[model samples]
Target chain A: MINNAGPSNSAAVLDEGVGPPSLSRLSDADLSSMLLIRHFEKNLLKLFEQGFLHGTTHTCLGQEYVPVTVTSLLGDADHVFSNHRGHGHYLARYADAEGLLAELLGRAGAVCGGVGGSQHLLRERFLSTGVQGQSLPVAAGVAWNLKRSTPGALACVYTGDGTWGEGVVYEALNITALWELPLLVVTENNGIAQSTPTGQHMAGDVRGRAAAFGIAYERFTDTDVTRLRAALQPLVEQVRHMSRPLVVEFVTHRLGPHSKGDDSRSPAELRAVRAADWALRYAAAHPEQFERIDAEQSRRVEQVVAEVLARPLTDWSPR
Target chain B: MTAPRVANDLNTALHRLFAEDERVILLGEDVCDPYGGAFKVTRGLSTRYPHRVRNTPISEGALVGVAGGLALAGDTAIAEVMFADFVTLAFDQLVNFASKSTAMYGRHLPLRLVVRCPTGGNRGYGPTHSQTPQKHLIGVPGLALYEASPLHDNHTLLTRILDGGVPAVLFEGKVLYGERMFTGGVIDDLYGYDLADGVARIRLHDPVPPDCVLITSGAMVHRTVEALRELLLHDEIVAEVLVVSRLYPVERAPLLSLTGPARRVAVIEESTAGGTWGAEVATALHPHLWGTLASPIRLIHSLDSIIPAAAHLERQVLVQSGTIRHAVKELVHG
Candidate 1:
């Protein structure tokens, strides 16, 4: 298991966030996905402002790379189970940005029949069990079912560092490994779980702990989409062909306080700081591709925002 | 003129089921290897079917959660709780997940699961281990409960529950584990009593007017019947007794139908009196049926505290068969 080893100082090297994939190389589809995540987060904020969105919202502002790339490796037949901060992950797979926006707005067109608001964005192919630390077992079950029924489909579960403390996750990890089930455990190591930083609260390395259970374990920076793809591609392929368990840990900054309920820092200040270096360096690296991708992302977002704003306020049709 | 063949008891019945169906896997703590179980009910199961009997870790919540998922995947998982007291850890999986899965999720998942809870207090295992926690689960809709007192009752109830594909709880009395019944005897064929609707066992007597009725169930029924048999020596208090073998989806029609002109009625239960079947029965019979009454409904129940360990202390706290007999006489004669 991942022992209580002290902070290895490798996190300090992430100051410039180098050695990761450049966003310049991202296809228009990937850029549209990234823009969808941003627009969804903004719309979620608007819903929270108007009192439509209930419960906590865990925006994947900084950690978009993990969902974007991991989902890129998944087919529609494959399944992904995520935690409360599931909007980014869910949309990354399903890509129904308006449906998620409608869900946050509690409209009839919402994916979960408008019953589950911000935290509970569940689609047919991609499922969120509407809980924290609870989806792993169900995901394992889904993986077990898939292994038996559909030989090629893989089940991926995304959990936070906070969920690592739960014994049920360990139980699921053990069972998945023992059964040689095709399960991918994705950990979003945001350095902080809500308020407490993982260095203080999390006992050990998340990936190493999974490795202790004999599951194939790997970790990367959440900003590094290409690197994540490289690491997860083999695992996903193995799940597709070999039926073995896999774990991928994406380490990065939360950039926001866990959810909308937390206002520990100014959102403008955090967004302003993160938006500068990452976007600028990527745009600088490849000018032609960046221009083309930016125009596509802008057009998609404008179209979605216009359509979303023009709709009636009240939901008339039954959910 | 005829004798019934030995249908075999619960343990042997389960052995037959496990042997018959490879999909029927038994899971719980101490179910394999060295320790068969706390009650030894599954003693020879592991030896019989090594791969089928799974001895799980001592995590009740995970055990039930895993069972729920397995059942959702179309596996017949019979999970055992050594003592009913420990079922509290698994109540969420039972009440929230399994019971509500079909209803809340629009029957997308078909949960064919059986939980065997060994309950009751005749042994020296104090308040913690002796509770009949079925009362807590009675309020949960969609799930059925099978409270078995006799060996044959359990066998019939298990088979009936297995045939019906909804979630069911089989509560076995700790005291009745070793009690043997002549399975070869020609017992009353109650195989047709709708498992969803409870069966009402009405012990017949000559010249039965059914003036007063006593309703009871579980281990208390054995004692209540014996005491009622003795009470028949002098007083012709021609009364009918309704034993609720299946606790949930309670056959209320049969209960109301069997009462006849029994104006006065009393209910005896060993579980907590509040929010129990006794309370529900009294509520259902009162108001409308008040005109047929010689007196109001009376209830004989256990004290509000947990059952004590000592047999003497337990008997003092809980209602005995004589207690039901006394209550019936007072209600009819008063």
Candidate 2:
């Protein structure tokens, strides 16, 4: 069962979310999930700096609230395919920190045997392309296959704002809308792709592009994870019941630069905004509960660190 | 003893294979229902097995990508490129993604995915739809390439590619789709011949005296075989003709074995001469079989330019029977 651990009073965030009405409601536990994602990202940055990691990573530091809220809208049978910045989406669903860290470290104990390093991180059935935008078409393919053979499982794809410009994305989107494939496409609008801002790069509106192809569309900001969950709820239910395509334009911010490559890294403005975000606020208000949540998350992260650090280096070489 | 010769059409060739294996699935644009396919190769496949045959919307990237995924998931999928030219649209998916998916992951592709692309020129298909770019996809490590020359073997090769447990590109000659060939005995399915590492010698005339070997593939094979017979001035100067079916894991052993004792050898193709098949064969054969050769390997190929629309100009650009005959004659006399 999915654990519902956030403070219990956040349900109101759903009824009056900024976007359209939501069919699926986010729980207090779902809100706690966002805090967990932020914690995971912090741990990753530390692991990366300490020389315990190899390969590139696209951290979803600012975009954590989207996947946390959106995935909670999906059922168990529903599958998701996310792009390079996928840790948020996968962990919100499977919640396995050890596998993600092991995968990033390129250890044999990693999920994909380190063949898939940081960017190519994966969990049991929740898959990530680890490459930008490449996962979009594959997700469409998975949706087509799932709809044709299994009937109940739904397919979801999480892509970046930069990814919308790729031809393969359009090809798959056109075909997905044409076939009315049962898929939920979430555009993680993090304002910047690597270092290029969306205004300078993306043309027009992402929702309009979907509407031009006759797809149902919705948009929401990331500050309130509960509202984001509510916005995704209706579409998730509609897709499951009707087996049609939907596009969710998530207005989120990248709290960090693209990767460790960015010299400038985080700014004070984002940190100030993040300080007041709902996830941290909820954790603080539920101090009695926060104590339990913090301890558990700490234990989880520690257990993961120990597990990864304790493993011996594998003697394999790439051909 | 042979199935009665029927009108050679792409549909018939596909049907013959569909009747042979249940694993052979047709996935591409208009492959089912109203359209049957852009070229109608999969015309009636959906009528018999609705679950297996699929008609996807115009998603070339997904067509190859999903086929790779399904192959990874254990299904033999025959992905069709409506025209060889459109394959450019899905180039990254095929070369960077599907071709390397198995080898990069350190896993054997249990997927038998055959990309059937209608290649070469004849129809006024113009620049966008009439290019032979199979050479572009050859460098991928895990893929096996095939250019089916005859109509009958196209069906056999499809069956073999799906059964062989390897990803393959089976190029169907747009020129030879409906053509008829009259012969005395049954032509063995080229699939029965090993296509690993080099070329196979298909003889048109017996007792080839082994003066010079004419090596070629695809549509050029038929013309080269015919040229060997028409230009033979004497029984002593025999021209051994080697036709390669697999381009990647090319049938090299047989080609090496055939040219090991020959005094001279020449490689011919319809594609540009220097960088591809001609260059590859010359590079491979020159080192190991250099001492045995009486003359440096000659390459007879089309001029490096866009295939023209004019019939005469097109013929001049492609390797013809006379071109092969002349190359062999020159190599033999050199």
Candidate 3:
């Protein structure tokens, strides 16, 4: 059985041979990627607080594992459409950190030429937008094109439980299933939307919602990297082979508030969630590997920050 | 080169485009083989290009969003919105996604998507169905806006837009769909005009020295042509008619050059007077023509009211030949 007690208990559950897989089982590359995302987000939060970054940012502080593991299963040609909370997704796709940072700072050197802030990041195969549920249909459209042009390629859309409330999600799901487009709809149900809890915003279960559209559904309560990779690899393969849409609702928690402005969670709740930080727990369980990876990620983040700071700031004025 | 009706010309354009490029895909509600389209503009397209032309559900947002996605994925897509009013349902996709994608991405996203909207009144489809919503789409940066005119070759225009490598919204006047157009001299031997820089000018009388210039587009071109004939025959007033095809990015040089020594100019359209295309054209022309004008440019348009279903009421509310004639006469005789 999977450890519902959270990431802190994941190591113990694995030692007892009771859970799916443990974070200690992740490859060096996978662990390094997750560490890089975590370090990058932490530094970004500092920059945001220092007023170096304009516009509000939605950080994926605790939800790094979901995107890291999911993106690992995807090939470079495959497309990814993400929602507002998409920093982790961008980093996982190996987007230039300097460009992403420049964009958040509203510089001309931004990936989107400073037009799209933190919420909207677009590479060749990766796209994210500020609007909720909008990317689902966009993913379906991309998947339709992939179905026609690139036979083996697939499209993945990362939405949230709050996005499930949007009517367009259902419309996109229906069309994706009807067309049998190769799409994977990842609902990162981080248990909250802005300030409201998921229960307040979501009606009915996500599994049932997927079932209504006659698509396959999977729920991952614990988003430990190894467990996620193990559960997702075969599913992604099946989706690519079958050329159909699948829903993977990841039930997790946000380590930080929704944005820089909102800090409304109770102290006890915050402490409890922080104690269950997956990376920290994994580090405690395996100290040597965690230290090596963490140090390397920290150095990389520091190097990127220094290099980006040394460059001239991009002009924010319209061309 | 065939002088078919505007609808048939559009069909011919689609047929040719499908045959030429495998990347071109046509999508909309009831645009399949049996249904073709509500206006039959996409007739026989699906039969010819079976998988390329697709019928979609009644979801306007998805239809447009999917078209944007297809374009981003390197396929040229043309989406047909049944009516201009239904374009409201697709504003998020067209304005937010399609228009802004390349700019937001800071790279050319290959968003070669065209949204075809059938606009205007006269068939009495009422307020919901017959609005000229092109005005709402005008000021959006990075979006190209075009209106089909019987005066210009729509086949060539469609081909140019598809090859233009941009996101565009093309408005086809519903009433003008069945109207026939020829290259020259159908109504009069003096109807000699050439399409230059997106503007087509038909002089009412050759070597007669136009007393005034009347500017219009879409179905209004037909009414303005008729009105010009009346003005020349009855009132002996020779006015040059300038029809604009690219509604946005209004090509001012060609229009101002063709206006040529005429002090009075009248701009007419089917949409409401407030913030209409006529207003934009007049605004653009004011500074350039201010010193040379005899009087202020005359902006003639429909009243700021919902288009009614009744024919007489619709006539009163919309710009007809009588209104065009009156507006032109006032501009010339004032």
Candidate 4:
């Protein structure tokens, strides 16, 4: 099995690229969304430790750019299907934080009325599932519709390195490519699948597998927000214009364990990953703006949590 | 409208649906012009609406999944699974996703999807090709299960389901597709009535009080009717046959009332004996009808074995007219 070299030096990865965008040039909404996601996940972890939260969550703590950048580029009509590690995607889709928190708390006001917890969040344009690789086929179906009914609309499904092992993903890819549906298959290759590393689960190259089906494939080696925006802007446009499926693989890292109660990584690996946290690096580079955004996001999260906590529990009776 | 063959009626329903709404799209393998469908229900549909009728690949899971997606996106989609047996490949999309999406998740999106499954045995297609899989989906919430019968208007049934804005699985009996349907005919001792709850009941011997109630659905209705005729003419025992159109969310009130003062009730289906639709009916009526019931409810279904391909053995395994007649006799005499 192929082992990941912990986390590479961010400076070396960044120095080779065009310099990071200045604070004014950056999207305030995107930054705030990332901050909110991070803070919300941190709160969830705390609540889980304190025995206040039930079940487990696969937090998108480190890989916030995946949703922040991609969802920002999507229109309200465009659809998104997300995987288990989809908290960031849910928040980025403009779902209210209280509704999400209430869902996790199993309240009637939750998005799914407490039936679907953290993993399954359903909205008009967004749908998330706990089942791995299911989003691809479902997204392909959505894309098939958009291709016929809505001309400019597109469907984007987010998967992980582990989900690539599912055979239905390839089946969906074949149909999407055959029909030339407007679908973007986003794979967040965080080099890990739950406790097991991705290399142990996946065989051969992901890009090569997608290429065999004649799908347009692209790989982003880093989770640099600006670079992601630049790369995806044209690609999303092209997909919408041509109404064809494209596969994009983003190589990133997860700073936290796979889920609650998972502590499989070594201390050195954990420290290395923490040192490479993209949010911390950005904060270290621009401390003043980071502090302001972090404070605002924390307050927003606290207010949402308070509102959710004040709500009554959901009726578990059959509807 | 003149009574047409079941297949012809289905074809006309597709034509009318396509003509009425541009949002109605048809998807399935070989569901195009020249080769309408395995049962010819979708015949000539692709020619009229080339853009709407899609000839999909042999991907049952993907086809159903895509239909769900289309429905979610505010389009009415009817996906035809050539054989009901192949629905196993799409259980996740149908049972888990399409059925549960609207109820478990909020009903933000309208899941107006109709999966047409051509089901039941007797074609000598063997175990894999011929099977009644409606029992597997009857209890799924947010999903309606409908079976087509020649006694009802196929056009009206389909139109009602499509306009209901819900996800439904319609099981079309393979053998019933070619059977002749009667629109209006008055032969002595034969009468037909459509219930408000989407059930079609045919009573043999109009003035005779029903000594027993024979419940069935789909193509089995014809076999039960034949058996009922035999019972009246040969055995001199009159029975009322209640054919359920909407099998799920089973309009229990109408069925219970229709059971009438009969102490003997029998449910005959073409599926297996254990955990079948007949079993559901028996269990649902057992509580209310127990005090009045002279004997236990009889569930007559095919034997618990794989359907054989041989014509002789297939006849023996399936619930034929002879089996129904025998079951009715046993229930009446017991």
Report the number of the highest-DockQ candidate.
Answer: 4
lDDT (tens digit, per residue) of candidate 3 on B179-222: 87656644456566777888887874355788888888877877
What's the TM-score of every candidate structure?
0.81, 0.86, 0.93, 0.93
**DockQ of predicted model 3:** 0.55
lDDT of 4 by residue, B1-334 (tens): 5557889988898898888888888899999989889788898988888888888888888888888888877788899999999998888887778877877664434577999999999999998988998888878877888899887788899987877766899999999888877565332346555554677667743456888988889779777777877898899888888888888877688888888777999988898976677788888899999999999999998988999999999999999999999988988887
In candidate 3, stretches whose alpha carbon ends up further than 4 angstroms from where it belongs are A1-24, A106-110, A315-319, B185-190, B205-207
Candidate 1 lDDT over residue span B1-334, tens digit each:
2322222256676787787766676778887756777767777889988866777667676666666665665667788887889888877667766666545422234566888888877676889887767778875776878777552345566667866777888887776665554233211331111122354444442335666778766556556666566556556666656667677766577777777677878887777777786777787778666888778788877778888888899877766667767777777778
Candidate 1 residue lDDT tens string, A81-166: 77778888977887787777666655545665555566544455565654556667657666766776789988888888777877
What local lDDT score does residue A150 receive in model 3, on the 0 to 100 scale? 89
* lDDT of residue A104 for candidate 3: 74
Order of models, best DockQ first: 4, 3, 2, 1
Screening candidate 1 with a backbone cut-off below 3 angstroms (N, C-alpha, C), the clashing residue pairs are: none
Off by over 4 Å in 4: A1-25, A107-109, A314-317, B107-109, B185-196
Worst ten in a row by lDDT for model 1 chain B: B186-195
Reference-based lDDT, residue A193, model 3: 79
Give the higher-TM-score candidate: 1 or 3: 3
Residue range B224-329, candidate 2, lDDT tens digits? 6567656655423567667677766655667787666887888887776556767777877788777778879899877787887777777777667877777777
Tens digit of per-residue lDDT, candidate 2, span A121-195: 445446666556666676666676667666766778888878877877777777777767788888877566776
What is the Å distance of residue B143 in model 2 from its true position? 2.5
Q: How well is each residue in A1-319 modelled by candidate 3, as lDDT tens digits?
A: 1223333211122222353344555777878888888888888888877777777888888788888889889998899998799988988887367788777765546787777888878887989988888877778888989998888799999988788887778878888898899999888876667876666666667888999989998988675777678888899998998999899988766788798859687776676567657887788778888899999998988887767666665654332
Q: What is the DockQ of each candidate?
A: 0.27, 0.34, 0.55, 0.57
